[model samples]
Target: MTLNSNFREAYRQAQSQDVIGPNVIPKALPFVGGGLILTALGVYGGLGVISNYPNAFMPSFWVALIAEIVLFFVARNVAEKGNNATATPILATYSLLSGYTLSAIILVALSTSGVGLPGIGIAAGGCGITFIAARQIGSNLSDRDGMALAQTVQLGLIALIVVLLGQLLFSLFGIYTPGWLEFAISGIGVVIFAGMAVVDFYIMPRSYKDEQYLSAALGMYLTYINLFIFILRLLIAINGGGRD
Candidate 1:
């Protein structure tokens, strides 16, 4: 049988089980944990970047946005062709290239602002470890056969609507959220990420080919990254202990 056929059969077996379905849970964990880590990184990275070299940092934000859009299409094509393994490697390459922007932000945060390097380092280390763990766990599941084109479009729309609406509300208020609110945001973000991970993990294996692993990885990576950032923001907002 072709890899695609094998992938479908395996997923069928995985889907048949009880208890949240093996096909679903592994993906769920990473989305929650990963999103928290990424969110934290984004906050620190943005703050750090703006603090050290304000101009360079902000532009990368736009650039990262564009890159994500490009990759989204690439991932979709790769998955349609049954190339899961290839998808992840390609995504890693993009991530490596794109990561520099965030790294620049991180460098600025740590070196320019001496707020608390040790604490940040500890948190950063923990986030990295968690990501590695999640990737490994989720990868163990059988491959997804492929999602319907409509489902893919629907998922993208859901993400866009949520993000745009959330940001709009925040922007309209000009509300610098209070410190305690951070925890609440983080808690909510965790729940969202967990659900996202479950959805992605279940969907990816069935829809994507082995060559599309990179694409799936990218999807997984973003989910975790978002989660991380939300968690981090919560931490910073709260830990500051009642901002000025």
Candidate 2:
């Protein structure tokens, strides 16, 4: 997803910084947790509308998706200026809308046999596991190792985006991705974003000053959410396209 195009900006800024904000991750953790909670609430609300007011779901979903795109850029801009009071709410709202738009995928997971709540749980759990490992390894990286990993992740992201665009263009022409290709793409996405989880730790401290924790939070939130998304996609692909 282009949802994290903002991260490239963060990565660019990280290259120039010689100092790291050792406290930023600790400070940003609460907001990350809060944003995620809001996201869950939004998902709950979206599921209700989808279940009970099916006719409105698609229209409302497109609006929410567009709003999310707008809010993300606005929040990042404000956060970069250190306007925490303004940016915090915008990021929160963006998180909520993000979950709302994700309802369609979650609904598909819910419908697939042997891949309902368990699949969702597993995807979420996978992100939590990634965070634990990333925190340890990402924090202790030698300077050379850190730079090398960052370069690898950057190239991976660029290549992944190109493949994804190709997939989208083909779908628009009624040439949807075959099941095996879908599985392969989603699996690669899982690997790429898992690498990103590590990079966020190494990059955030270098990219942001103490005042810009919201930006860090936004980046961290994007990492895990995208991880969640790709994991869910992998699950759906593995289960044979959400239904028989």
Candidate 3:
């Protein structure tokens, strides 16, 4: 089916548009905030290790990266099964590991001439702004608008994943994306995740029932994290694309 038709079929029956889980968003918001804070702590710790014991940083980073990937699937599975007790620590660890891996980009941003702390702040502020706007827009969307927008962003996300995979493959061969392509990729990433920030507000209510708040929280956290990464990437691309 065409995207619009598919959305129409899927969401037409979900006519209420009211959030399925009234408590989900409220409960998830706190966890989301806590997760981000933990991520910041992880980044701080990672930065220290990288600066003082640079050799140790790479091995530790790889371990953390692998663990982070594993934890994501583990936590997601537990959360979806409504095992919040089991998922909570797993998700927290995932967030911290995520931040540790992210420190590499944070390091790049820090070293870039014009994309230092201020750029990080801007990227963060952008997410905050997007959240506020999306909450308003996505929460009130009619079934049609909400589903259409969600599907569009879903397509964008799939495309983004494929592109990122391609970039990773090239990197393995020591071929980094050029400055111009970096701008294109980063720009597209920023746009797609910004769109996802909106879609999350719409999808959560329909996708997760009231009891699945932990799963909902994980979804929101991923959206926020990806959005932050892309915005930071854009800043780095603009200021000093080839430097890193």
RMSD of each: 9.3, 1.4, 4.7
Q: Candidate 2 residues 173-228, lDDT tens each?
A: 88888888888888999998999989888888998888889999998999889899
User: How accurate locally, in lDDT, is each candidate?
Assistant: 0.48, 0.87, 0.79
Two-way TM-score contest, 1 vs 2, winner: 2
Off by over 4 Å in 2: 242-244
lDDT by residue (tens digit), candidate 1, 1-244: 0001122333343354332333433433443344345544555555666678878865776776577556656754674465656554444434443444455434433443332565456545645665565446444434342233224434543554465467558858885545565456555654555444444555555544444344344556665555444444444544553233
lDDT (Cα) of model 1: 0.48
Q: Give per-model TM-scores.
A: 0.53, 0.96, 0.91
Give the per-residue lDDT of model 3 (tens digit) for 139-201.
888878887787787677668778888988998999888887788888998787777777777
Question: Which candidate gets the maximum lDDT versus the true structure?
Answer: 2
Q: Clashes in candidate 3: how many?
A: 0
Model 2 clashing residue pairs (backbone): none
Error of 2 at 114 (Å): 1.8
